[model samples]
Target: MRTGVPLRQESLVTPLRLPSLIGCALSLALAAGAAFAQTGTPALPPADEREPIRLLVGLPPGSGVDRISRVFAEALSQRLFRPVNVENRTGARGNVAGEELARSTPDGNTLGVVTATTMILNRHLSRQMGYDPQADLTPISRFASLPLLVLGGPGQGVRTIGELIEVLKARPSTCGTPGAGTAQHLALELLIRSVGARCDFVHFRGIAGALPELLDGGVQVYVEAAVIGLPLVREGRVRLLAVTSRVRSALLPETPTVAETVAGYEAETWLALMGPRGLADSVLVKLEAAAIAVARDAAVVRRLRALSAEPIGGTRTELAATIRAQDSIWGPVARAAGVTAD
Candidate 1:
């Protein structure tokens, strides 16, 4: 420790030694570059390119929407070669997340997964929506759809749509839905209007609270997503009479569509990928590819179907059309039902 030993032969910054030092540094850099080329390793990404992609979700973790959003996020993380994170920004039935997504920078790194409710019904029901869904958001893809089921527990008398409608028309009955202005609630209203039947509609915070009421015959019939309704049907807690989709659900192949009886009736809630408007077209195309890939992945399709959702993985145009279709259906139903967030 006491010895003053010289570490280098050249003076630290002599003009004569500087060129040699520079030459050595250049040689080393070139060598490193050549090694990287030979090894097929990518050069380090620029600072912005290394940033993680944030995938905002409009629901809480462990909820069906959040779980499905995570599945897409994982697949996208692999496809995009970036960390795609799922952040649960839950409130106002998804508006909280929608508004935030609309305000985020128009980079592919920031995107959102939202349901039909946020895109269509919320705009009609809530006066305080912070952003215009149509104007402020750029559609990417429609990934998953949940076909609702018209369910009745074994304790109820009816088993088919015809029988239920006949009973409902003959005598006023009580029906249940997840909430006042949900897709399930609108479907119920549409059914009532379509069939010229009357039922005192009961709304719950979620289907979980309403399930016990349905089983006990407190409510004659209930409308719920297949993800929640199918398990109850399999357990004999509820009977699946009809599906609310243009076609019958694959999970319940024999079941008739609501449209079969009430011609032109269909209401399916779907999840879509979107970014704030002004996102580059290149970014949208790249994201669309990842979405289509996930939709076509057999394993991913199986997992989504297991969760009672059908995989769509459709183009941005399909998502826009789906949103517009919901506007045609749910907006009218909500108005007829006298529903408003206020």
Candidate 2:
């Protein structure tokens, strides 16, 4: 049996508990090998294809997104019969890597995981961008939904949303988030505004950067992502006050939703597979198939859910619709918060 611990560089589906996915992929690989050995079949990886594909990540190495991308890339290499390499560009809240993907050759050789925040919300939040997200990229598929949380700092004793609100109303508090225009920032702002509480937001380049302040009481609360925050909560370093999803998280069923206290407040974010605009339909189709298959890999789903990221192996059409749908939700939030690129 596989370990159920998914994601490594070379082979993600193996050593993980995804029997069906591994069996199917191995069958396809074996069948392709046999086709070339016995009869006059077209074979699996076409004779003419040999170039490696590159996946651009907009975060530092070892970040959850980077690790997640490597998992998908390794699996895709198997399906496409090409080496898939992950490259980290890391800056501008993912815009740095996004620009690289936008400018890369679109002949299926280059693709990227553009955070949904960068694609949908940056249009309103960033005053200076190197490229237009919609015009510069082609949708492949959406693979994950990262849930956000309202985390209370140590010594606060603000264990619930109501207690947190009482403290917010009693005195000005500092709220921290990874970046200025991130879903966490907006969601944190929404919570304060909705509860009629007062707080000033402190923006850091990443959640790790703000951890010291939060633990020291310099920052009272933080909008943390479950991928990284769950470990902190489990370690007793921080308290999870509430989940920012519209509904309570399955991982913490007893935890209340921020919406339950304030109403209509959600700040969920996600990542999607994309290639530069003008990509050939054939290449897009191949990428889409590989991404969807890897996302639905039973092991990937289990590991992701454990981290509070719901796996969604949606199609290109679905991703495009999501792009269209998010403008209405986050645009107003960004405007109301008066957030802009820093």
Candidate 3:
């Protein structure tokens, strides 16, 4: 009887052990899968199996934004082993492009290059803007920043911010800007208000239109991107009094920043990648990685430097926070300055 009891107990224990081993294997497999996900190695579709990516640019071809977008598109294509194309959808101060991007499918195929003007200033200036930047888009990363240069023409007779302020207060100095609500215009307005100086803004259609006027002294001071102004400065057509970046630019280390003289003043235009809302975490991770890789690439860095723009790659959270902060700061300034596009 004891031998029979031992055999039955052994049979029961064997079945229980088989289930326990299977459960342990399943637990290990699950843990490994979780670990892989945590490492940003989530399973993505094969490059060949995915559709070509469309990089929506808000400016026309040959514009600064378009040029930067093409650089990033090439790098992203190489990284993802897929084709990427730039689509120019220019109109209504980038509202046309922003709306298109916002309305795109949340899938990773469609992305847009956004600027400080498009993401932060447009909404405050135009009530007809179709999309809300904070709600309609998911910021992927900020890839580059273009610093504005404070330029003085022949008649200005100012070589520094202090001299410029004194000139403005002494007489009626005219400042030329690309447009009413443009980054250049806003920066000039902010500077005037911050320093409590009297300066009038002359709105021009574009920088090309403003350049000749500036050279002829019709416009005493002109604030524009370094890329556009630096060539003239090099030729001695204009003088760079100060740069609007918080730190001295690498391209022009001899120049001082506006903050050095104004106590606290900085303004720059930035380029960032963003997608429609509801983007998957895996897709966001992949996009951000590709952007950062491009921003850090030696060749890409050189190209950006040539354009007088600096590579600044950071996480999505950082881009979102920048939009929020800039919106807060620029909104009230725009209102006070009576800057409106529409």
Candidate 4:
């Protein structure tokens, strides 16, 4: 026979209902206060929530774009009372990070540090990109511009654009690109078509991959952003034939402009910080201010110049207009060049 022990009331302890009630009430009140605080005003960051500001880049580590973004991150952290973090999400010629940024929340927390190639050229190249650079992304600020330089490999013994043109006329030489449909490729295309120069085109995975071929005398000339070309010029690994922009680069002051010889030649690449479109005015304003302040910093300017980049800070409207202008200008050029994304 089983004997059932009498159950004691005290044995079954009840939870502290009063404390739970109090906690729930407190949580509701705090949430209500936050909601009320944000009701009429822009969703300003909570005063106590010092979350990290993520600046996403589309280039690999140690790249000029990455370096400039990191430098701005340090400067922005000082300007904003929060930590600034840079994340590299490289692929699709920078369209990967551009797409990510375009689809991200427009809360001013996530930003894309992008170049004109991603903004202007990739659209012309790629047929099925996930997002539209001009439509999905809001350009908050233009940070910098990098001019491209036309350089000659050892085979030509060419010291100037004129000499290089002469050599190309004498014999067919090939120019190298980081890849097809890149800004570098477009520059070479324009150069070749403009002057009717005879040259074959070679595509590499990146400037680094193509650089070895240049050094081995496999490619005679390459048009690359000064950030990539300046180092080789300094090391005597390559000779700068000419820069594309009208004015000479501060980093390579001695290198003359191809524009001087081939008038109307310019392929200056730009870098900017942008966020998802429809970002609230308040958040957009703060981000724009932060970016402009960082670009205006003397230290930032010096560091950017060291990378052969020029710092340029402008309003959202200004950046948007620039994007539109570039789209108009390069869209036709890209089509004419028969550039397609790989």
Count clashing pairs, candidate 4: 0
Q: List the residue pairs that clash in candidate 4.
A: none
| Native-structure RMSD, model 1 | 7.2
Flag regions of model 2 displaced more than 4 Å: 1-43, 169-171, 204-218, 305-308
Candidate 4 has an lDDT of 0.84
Please give, for residues 27-86, the per-residue lDDT of candidate 3 as tens digits. 999998998988966556676536899888999999877887888888878877778999
Better structure of 2 and 4 per TM-score: 4
TM-score of model number 2:
0.79
What lDDT is reached at residue 108 by model 2?
86
Every candidate's lDDT: 0.88, 0.84, 0.87, 0.84
Per-candidate clash tally? 0, 1, 0, 0
Query: Mind giving the per-residue lDDT tens digits that candidate 4 earns over 25-74?
Result: 99999887898888844345567446887889999999888998899889
Which residue pairs clash in candidate 1?
none
TM-score of each: 0.85, 0.79, 0.85, 0.80
Local error of candidate 3 at residue 86 (angstroms): 0.4
Worst 10 residues of 3 by lDDT: 5-14
Candidate 3, residue 307: the lDDT equals: 76
